[model samples]
Target: MITRILLAVDDSPAAMASARHAIELAACLGARLHVVTVVPDHSLSNLVTRMGSHPGVHERRDQAAEAILDHVVRLARASEVEADAHLLEGDAARRILAEARSMHADLIVVGRSEGLDRSTTAHILEFAGQPVLVVPPEVR
Candidate 1:
């Protein structure tokens, strides 16, 4: 009964693994995939300015987010699953949860990294109204 699946991803290996799982699941369930990656909101830091690395930081982050989303979307399409890409900026967990709610997703999928005290997957699980699948890196 999972017609819509929202997948939150990043550049981590775990995220890529989760993407693969999501693609397969969507294909099996005849579901559409909503793929999203967040560009973290960065606060101005004196160190960054002093180091002359602040100028392209936002651009680079945005590009990276786009790349991640694009990769996932391509994978989903190659698997014959319909996919949409969303590039968001702000707190990762908050944005992801908001996107899921906006899309009325039937399920949420995210990757969990081992040994992290607090993770986006944890936050999404704590707040998501729908079922969430947490894929570990070793799954694939």
Candidate 2:
């Protein structure tokens, strides 16, 4: 009964792999895909502004997130699955969970990058109310 799937993705290789898996799963289940990408808040940029960083850091992040989401949506639709894209700002896990709930998703899918920042995935696993499917880096 997985009619709605929420996929949280980034631009990493592992994330792309997860996107592919999500597309396949959605097609197989005849489910719609909700693709989401989150941009961190401006706190870091504000702090770094004193050191000479530009003020458009958050804007750049937003653009990047939008680009990633667009790519994901294109892939999903190319697979013949209904797909929508979302760009969210704030804590990655919090925004993702909120989006999933708002969209009435039946399952959550996330990609684990090879790097050490597992905080987002861990947070989702610890707090998500629905079942979560984690696509690991090795799956690539």
Give the alpha-carbon lDDT of every model. 0.87, 0.88
Candidate 1 segments exceeding 4 Å error:
44-54, 115-117
- CA RMSD for every model? 2.1, 1.7
Models 1 onward score TM values of 0.90, 0.90
In terms of TM-score, how similar is model 2 to the real structure? 0.90
Candidate 2 lDDT tens digits, 1-140? 99999999998877888899999999999999999888787788777766785767767778888999999999998999999998888998999999988888999999985556588888999999899999876532
- The residue pairs that clash in candidate 1, if any, are none
CA deviation > 4 Å runs, candidate 2: 53-55, 138-140
Please, what are the lDDT tens digits per residue for candidate 1 over residues 1-140?
Answer: 89999998888888999999999999999999999987766664334666885667666777888989999999999999999998887888899899999999999999886665147678889999999999888743
